[model samples]
Target: MTQSTIAAPGRAGSRGRSLIGLAAFVILVDVASATASSVTLPQIDGWYAGLEKPWFNPPDWLFGPVWTVLYGMMAVAGWLVWRDRGLAGARGPLLLFGLQLGLNILWSLIFFGMQQPGLAFAEISALWIAVAATMVAFWRVRPLAGWLFVPYLLWVSYAAVLNASVWLLNA
Candidate 1:
């Protein structure tokens, strides 16, 4: 076979491996954020158990599965963007994604770890905005990526309301 033909397959394989590596890195980042937020799980049974949650507050058992799915979607969404537009090209959208992820962790820390639902309400409101912006940015890059974030944005919207209710009821 010609050198050009032989080298083409090697380049394709290298590109595929790089894409896979990028996907793994994105997933690891998201998992790390989830793990960081989970540090407050002990307080869920200790402190959160005593809070005056709204009538609509979901059962504790539901949170784990719901968050697992949401985080998976978030990782995929981010990877899709980066896959389409690399880091430099997708900086703004990725930054928005990171902001929302950080806000997600902060909300848990404030509400569960610090036992400050009031402060968490403010943080989650900001998170909602960040998620919305990230969703829009992702949509601009890849429509499917944007679609993946819909559930997350909706969930955060609901969580924001739930947080406000809990804060008001307890305060």
Candidate 2:
């Protein structure tokens, strides 16, 4: 039987707990991506600070709080999908989740670790696409889940322009 139709003794409680875990896992993934990408922070303090950034670029301090909330929302979105059909049931949605998450982490690595603004710009463009795809897929499974990514998509869109500007100015 499907998840909504299932009837069991402790299944509801069990799923409630597991869903929390799943959400936490998604948050952790975001944290890990941030951590790995942080290798570039030092560069930002020195080399990056020397580069010409657009007037509209946000202050560095704003990123931490923004990402924390975004990550939490992302986890909730993923968990909603997982809660619908468990691991196997939400395989397609989860796979899209994984794809976007990987792209997220990869963007940090490419941008900060490699110190290649142009390359990183291209990478973030792909990340934007991946995130959009994930959001669409999640929405297909659960409408609320899809809506959760709205802010994320908007932020990434802004980030893309910032990235492009930085690359051009630096080049």
Q: Report, for every candidate in turn, its global Cα lDDT versus the true structure.
A: 0.81, 0.79
RMSD in order of candidates: 4.8, 3.3
Error of 2 at 53 (Å): 0.4
The alpha-carbon lDDT assigned to residue 47 of candidate 2 equals 72
Backbone clash pairs for candidate 2 read: none
Number of clashes recorded per candidate: 0, 0
Cα lDDT of model 1 by residue, 28-145, tens digit = 7567566655766888778888888898999999987888788888888887777666666688998998888888888877888788888998889899999999999999989999
Clashing pairs in 1: none
Candidate with the greatest lDDT versus the true structure: 1
**True-structure lDDT of candidate 1:** 0.81
**Candidate 2 lDDT tens digits, 76-171:** 888777766666667877898888888788777777778788898898888899889989988998899999999999999998899899999989
| Residue 125 lDDT, candidate 2, scale 0-100 | 89
